[model samples]
Target: MTNDHAETPPSGLRIPAEPVPLSEVARFDHETDVLVVGFGCAGAAAAREAAAAGADVLVLERFSGPGGSTAQSGGEVYLGGGTRVQKACGFDDTPEDMYAYLHAALGPHVDEEKLRLYCEGGVEHFEWFRACGVPFQESLYGEPGWMAPTKDGLMWLGENAWPYDTLARPVPRGHRPPVEGFAGGLLMERLAAAATAAGARAHTDTRASALVVDASGRVAGVVARRFGEEVHYRARKGVVLTTGGFVDDEEMVSHHAPLLSGHGKVSDGGDDGSGIRMACALGAATRRMASVEAALIVMPEAACRGMLVNALGQRFINEDVYPGLFSHAALHQPAPWWVILDEEGFAAYSARNPTAMPPDHVAETLAELEEELGIPAGALETTVTTYNRHAALGEDALFHKNPKWLRELKAPFAAIDPRVLARLAENRREATGISGFTLGGLHTTVDGEVLHVTGRPIPGLYAAGRASAGIHGDGYVSGTSIGDGTFFGRRAGRAAAG
Candidate 1:
């Protein structure tokens, strides 16, 4: 099983971004009706769906096993429109309501058709997860963070708390697996098991080096490297790229997502832009390549009780919005961000996490604290006075923070800088720090067919998950990644099988 046209370059054998001509292949080591690259959540779902659709499916994984960034996540699937879990939790949701909220929050260029389809198919997708043996409890955990405090199945993982709550009927859509800790590993394990039970064969430690194309420029197969040997696997139907994002690729990050460069990445190290590069070599179009999901992990509940101020000591965003939104806003503000908290707010935050780092600056009075933080004279005082005036009236006149967490800041104020840059200066990784992944990739159709820059679907080529920029546009909802991956992965597999 050798490709005479394939040559090891000076950099050694690597996944070629360019495609290989099928006429040069003397033999194929394996053959399948649908070939899936990268055995993460998307790959597993694709393989399962293709095999169940009566197609022979083969999955290639670069790692020793499955579970890419999906396993590193909190395992919350964003599902709405009156799912069984939602109904059991005594919450009413409709596809229209979900669509409206997503349309408003997803972006300046939201995918209307994909959003509508995702909302309409939410219930069916929930059922599919159940069929795959992914468990969901009926309980609801009303917490601030993405993951549920308990093994509860539902929570708010989007901008469903403050200003966005007024956009549509807010409903908890983050569906978590029934596990006490982070359920991402459990979720992927169940999905992979289901895929295996459905008769999908997976070849682990097999890195797809190049895509093979016929004379007509249609994708026909893949050339992979396994144990230092090159193997060609032919796909009679199509090839689906399910490899994760480009967050781990420094060069790619610096070129496209410069904001995320030098920041901590929330990836499984397999997201090296290989899949995206391979597709781009074939002239595949991309979307939102600059969009990223950066998380400023200051205790959200505690932040809601206090306030986030920039270097000039001015509030920019409502404290009660989703953390992802909060982080997005924080990144664009002036440097040296700080979370200002009073005694009560600090106590509440400390109770949530006892091991948190001490406050960066503390003072008995507002002016003293302002001086200690080296804020512009009278800036902190003016901001606090205005905030207290509105907070006392149970109203936020500026940013419109939720009234429930609003309170006047009195004497004895403290400030904590949660920026990763601040922590890195001290050579520490602890405390709340910025960590994120790239949210942009190849552009594809609803059926997961990769599209060209000219807006035509590439024959015999498909993609899903982070490999293809799907639902996310400008902003990200916590569970949407896993949700988008599994949902569209099934569609890609079924489409390729046909």
Candidate 2:
């Protein structure tokens, strides 16, 4: 169960703030130009930018170090929409193209102008990271990445209205820093170092149990359980909620995203839907509930354990095509897919380099699937034969699998890990991704304002990252999340400094 891929809150989780006298009702522990709540990429960027802008910045993280889900990411920044990174990667993209792509991808569930501004800012933000000492090596030469398309396939041909991020024409636009090891992890290390160097004070090993609402109903600060004791920290400027999405909160997932395995455990206890629940308590209007989902990874450890069956009791898609979409395929098959793999498949996945070989390359027989997936003897035997037979010929003469994505294969279930689990159809739906979220918390303007339940912006408040909505739309390309974190973090920092 233990390996590099297993989820562990990134190191450096215990951050300390000097204690105050017990007599004081509130400690007002410290103050900053920008008070960033949740020290993930978004929060860290906000703190770093604010501090770099000569404003005292305060950063609070529930875990030991930075990197909410970001710490666990593959480090592929999806910076599309005419970003300098995009142009440098040798692709022609524009804000208009970004807006069109998202609109086409999401159909009616998107805001165009907000998305355009986000794209326009995306390029600048990427440059800012490099400008600020976070080294990002460009990936201009690699295999074509998975891209989504309109049912009509118009996104790649050129100018099409309402194009989604998945429809994005594939390009080598991703960038990573030169960290000797863990190519994706280096980015997080650099950002954390930058935040600390910029004089941003971060408190780790702290849990924000509740949001403090003043007599004026403005969000004052947070009442936290730190070091196993109650502590209060007030934000003089604004409280930015970059706590991240609720992937591991089983109760919340069951209540909201039912189609998925609601019982999935978070990498850490940090993502407990604290921000979402806090806003809801104060009457923050939540828009899409069942709509938004996250990257569902089926690893050795997960809550749901069962046999995946297809409509005709067969396997579909190259389940091991890529780690990102593997969970989606698991959750959305016409029927549950039968998990099939062998010792060789398991060992191959254990290797650090899995992309070199397909999951199917691992040998698996019908009997093996019967033991692993628990399907009936005859039904599973036929399914395995059909899958192996059809998959080898490079044609889904039976399932109509997308030819571009299909290849003949052995057992893919073991390509990633020896274990398997159930997921939601939305988890695989190309339109849904971390970029597809509609973040709404303090509803701060581009300048960052803490908004009331009625949509009135609170003075002395601001926000950046997925903590605020309308920053990203349906079709999020790579690198934009970090772009927003850096760009808006700096902007919010400057605004707070003023």
Candidate 3:
């Protein structure tokens, strides 16, 4: 199946190599103490912070409006470790625990210094967000799934799943802002306003074409295409690139992260890998470009209680892990995956999962389902028989699914693709069924200064959010992106201002 969205664009919009040297640049059309590209949460937060630090900041946004993929997100900020909200809700959390969990979740992608700074400053960052006008209620959601349908402040996105559950004292860290729907839009609204109020001027419909490097090898400004004109915007102090990742650029995705080729991209249009390419032109080093965060969300309650099987009809993962984690596993396994449930399970899930379409296959017995699915004569039957026996005993010895969700499958049987389950659940933004974005980008230090191949900082350049990599590795806990953006974005802005 050809994906039209991945078609190539004109050469002008194509990713660039080394930017034009500043000496070759004719004149500056605009100037600021600090220049920021991409007005998403990271850019907005960086602009606001730089402005507060007494730098004359200007932001360039590719979109006509403010929100980027952030607006299309669930708006859960992965925050914990004794935040005011956690304390107010009577849950005890510590930075040590949060650090431990993140250390495990991030795997080889972990930045020790950055993780230490983020965890140690987690509480203070939460306070800073509160001051920025983002609101959180002191409520908790006990159910296992994606973001709470309501405006509850706390829910479990993936923290309770193994091995994170055993890694730290598992607590609800996904803090959803108080918005009726799609809280990321609200977060962007408030933060964008905060940036403007902080005296940061934003130019909409502005796309950065290349970095402007001076003769001494410092990034002094940017060459941008705005309103169909090429203009030079000079930054006296520094330039911060927060233009997000390359998930939407099919060519880049295939080149860097081929595993994500078949999945749907979950980004706004601005994430085209141009930022990373432009930075790389100046010798910026990047890491983990192949790491993609695929999401598995909004599984029906019955689907939650059901089991997933690959082509061989064998259960491969615990049913209760974060949907994204499940999706990652599923993608690695053979395709044509199915989530099998019984009539009882469907009945339990139907009301909660109102968006779910009818099952792809429904049959009076397991044999009939296997025949319809074209599986070998008794493979599914044998798998289901073993699963039921173990579920009846409340013990999943093979995969260790939580006993509370374990149940025997009795006829009539129903089977649906796990991919369909992700698409049907329409409670969140960006992606519903299994959708994802790239998690890798230009490498940077803890202070958000972009690094070179020699492990040295490129003077006067910094990056944050998806623009900089090394936060998440193979798996992602929800809210980490927003949390990372706001947290490290501040550091980048401040570093640039200095």
What C-alpha lDDT values do all the predictions have?
Answer: 0.85, 0.50, 0.81
Which stretches of candidate 1 lie above 4 Å from their native place?
1-15, 354-357, 420-432
TM-score of each: 0.94, 0.67, 0.93
Model 2 alpha-carbon drift over 4 Å, by segment: 1-27, 82-89, 102-108, 144-170, 179-184, 263-266, 293-330, 338-450, 459-498
Cα lDDT of model 1 by residue, 1-498, tens digit = 112222333432345678889999999999999999988899999999999999999999877788888887789898999999999999999998887777776776777788789999999999999999999999898877756668999988654666668888989888999887599999999999999999999988788887888999899999888778899999999999999999878778899998777667788866887888888888899988988988875767767888988889999998888788888787788766788999888988788767667787889988898898889988988999999999999999998887888889887999887764446633566533677899889999999999989999989999999998888778887888899899999999999988
1 against 3, candidate with superior lDDT: 1
Q: Give me the overall lDDT of model 3.
A: 0.81
Better of 2 and 3 by TM-score: 3
What ranking of all candidate models by TM-score puts the best one first?
Answer: 1, 3, 2
What is candidate 3's lDDT per residue for 415-453, written digit by digit as tens?
876555555453333332466888889999877899998
- Of candidate 3, the 10-residue stretch with the lowest lDDT total is 1-10
lDDT of candidate 2 over 258-355, digit per residue (tens): 55443243233455556666655565544334433324334311111112244345654443222233444445654333334444444543353343
